[model samples]
Structure formats: C-alpha cells, structure tokens
Target: MFFDKSHLVALGGNMPSAKGESVETLRAALDRIASSGCELLAVSRFYRTPCFPPGAGPDYVNAAARIACDAAPEAVLNLLHRVEAEFGRERVKRWGQRTLDLDLIGAGDAVLPDAATYQAWHDLAPDAQQSEAPDRLILPHPRMHERAFVLVPLADVAPEWRHPVLGRTVVEMRDALPDDALSEVVAL
Candidate 1:
C-alpha cells in the first residue's frame, strides 16, 4: 500500500445543508473514499466546538480518523482537495467558513520540510515563523505541539503518538498548554 503507515485525517465545518454542504455531508465524502479503496483505520470522537474564525457563526463538529491507502502523498492531498470541493469549500477566504474541511494531518514519516510546508504555515498565520527547535514540516507545527485541536484528540486515539520533531507524546503537549489556551478548545 502507498500509505503503509497510518494517516491522521481531520474533518470539520457545519452539518450538510439541503441547498448547501455541511458537516453531515462528510459521511458521503468518507463513503466515497472507502468505495475508492482506502482502508479505514480508526475514527475519533466527534467534537462540537465554535468555528475557528470566531464571531457569530455555527459551531463545528470536529473529529479525527485514520486511513490506509495506496496513493502517494501528493495524490492524497489532491483527493482531499477534490473532496473539499464536492462539499462546497472555496478558496475565496483563507480559513473562512466552509461546509467541510478535510486535512491529511500526517502520512507516515515523510518529512516534507521545504518551502511548500512553510508556505502552508504562512497561509495559516502570516506572522507565524518557521523555527528550528522542534522542526516538523518546516517549523511552527513542531510535532503538533502548538495545535491543541490536533493534539487533544490525537492523544485520545494515539496517546503515545510521538512528534517526529520534538519527540514528545501528544499527552505531554496537551498538558503543557497554558490553561487559558486549553480553554480555547471550547472556542474551536
């Protein structure tokens, strides 16, 4: 299989709409991928949290899942983009509200620390810098330590999941978060 190692996938946004797409619409998207031949690994508990951009918006049902597929990394990314389009996601606004958001969090040990990954970081937050300390996919992500949304549930399923860069467990990172920031989970 091209994806011999387990992959961490996350899905979010609103529930499916009759005239538009939403979180509930993600099931069909997953079904399509399954029909396409990807093997299901595990699905995390769904979480209902506030929208990432804040303001008066609908809450999002977030969850993580593991998958094994016979597609290359770039191919997998392309498929994710296609899935997002099918769900009504648009590129008009960065991190803007959407119907469904699917992200291939990690794929095996493929460390793609180049300009592209850094570009993604920049897109996430222009001020975010690529530090050298932890070092996973450029910088900022640093083994997923800085991302509570990624670490909390990731720890739930893969408690012992190690950061390819910092060498710390998910639980440790979660524990290390400032209490105020930990409260942000409710704001997700």
Candidate 2:
C-alpha cells in the first residue's frame, strides 16, 4: 500500500517566498515534486481558502494533486518535507502559516502506521488538534475529512478516491461539510 502509484497530495501556501505569491510558490513546488521521481498526473484548480486559526495569518491558495510515485509512505513524506523546506517552509509552529505546505494525503489505499493509530489521531479533540502534533507520520491525513481547503480541491483531482478507513469518497467528504465552510474555499 505504501508504494501505491496513486499518491494523493494537498498543496498550499499563505506567505510569500523566494517564488513570490502563494500560487507561484505552489506551482513551483509542484514541479519540484514531479521532478523528484514522482509522475505528476492531474492537479486541481487553485482555490483561495481562509486561513485557519482565524487571524493566525493571511488566506491561503490551495490545490490537490494526483501522482504516480513508487515509494514508501515514509519516503514520500520525507520527500514532501524536503520539498517544503526547499521553498523556505519552517517547522516552527504547529499549523503555522507557511511559505509552502505539501501534505501526503494518502498512497492508494494505504493505512499508515495502523488503523488504531489512525483512529486515535482521527478522533483527537479539536482543541488538542490545535496544540498537539503527532511525532510520527499518519496516513490519509487525520483531518483531511474535515478541511474544506483540503477536500474541496481533492475532489477536483481524486473525487472517487475513497478514504481507506472511513470508506467515504472525497466528494462525499467535501459535501458533508457545512455550507459556510465550503463557501470559504472559493475557486481562484
């Protein structure tokens, strides 16, 4: 499962970087990602999303991508982190505004770590989610189901991709969010 070719990625950025605006930064990051042995397939249209934590920072430009990378989940995660770093991403804050963010949503139907670990992080309380961070990597991104910024764009590229644990499709997850939340994730 880790080596599954259908690798889903969620790309985002808020702050300006060496590449200029978020969209420009993300586009460059996508190219970097594709060149790193991962074949970039389809990419979702860019969307403008409200920054999380309210006034924590400016809004973000987000998008999702589908790729074919024959690599282990951890290796893929490391690759993503490395890409983020290349664009000046810092691990200073948990959920902090960043110059680049590349999240490995999932690899095909892989359930990282294990179902139990995934569930533990999935069920993590909202307050805890803001302050706490997992020391290890979790697959399908524990909160992908709840973030319109993530799912709305994901639906664009991998609408039919089902969550390995929740058994829900990306479109289904996106539709389940409140209308107000969905409204915040507007197409750019």
Residue pairs with backbone overlap in model 2: none
Best lDDT among the predictions, by candidate number: 2
Tens-digit lDDT string for candidate 2 (1-188): 33577789999999999999999999999999888999888999999998987888999999999988877878888999999999999999988999999999988888878999999999999889989988888997999998999999999999999998999999999999999999999998
TM-score of 2: 0.97
Model 2 alpha-carbon drift over 4 Å, by segment: none
lDDT of 1 by residue, 46-117 (tens): 666666556636777676677778877666667777877876777665556677777776666554555467
lDDT of model 1, residue 134:
20
Cα displacement (Å) at residue 106, model 1: 0.9
Error of 2 at 140 (Å): 1.4
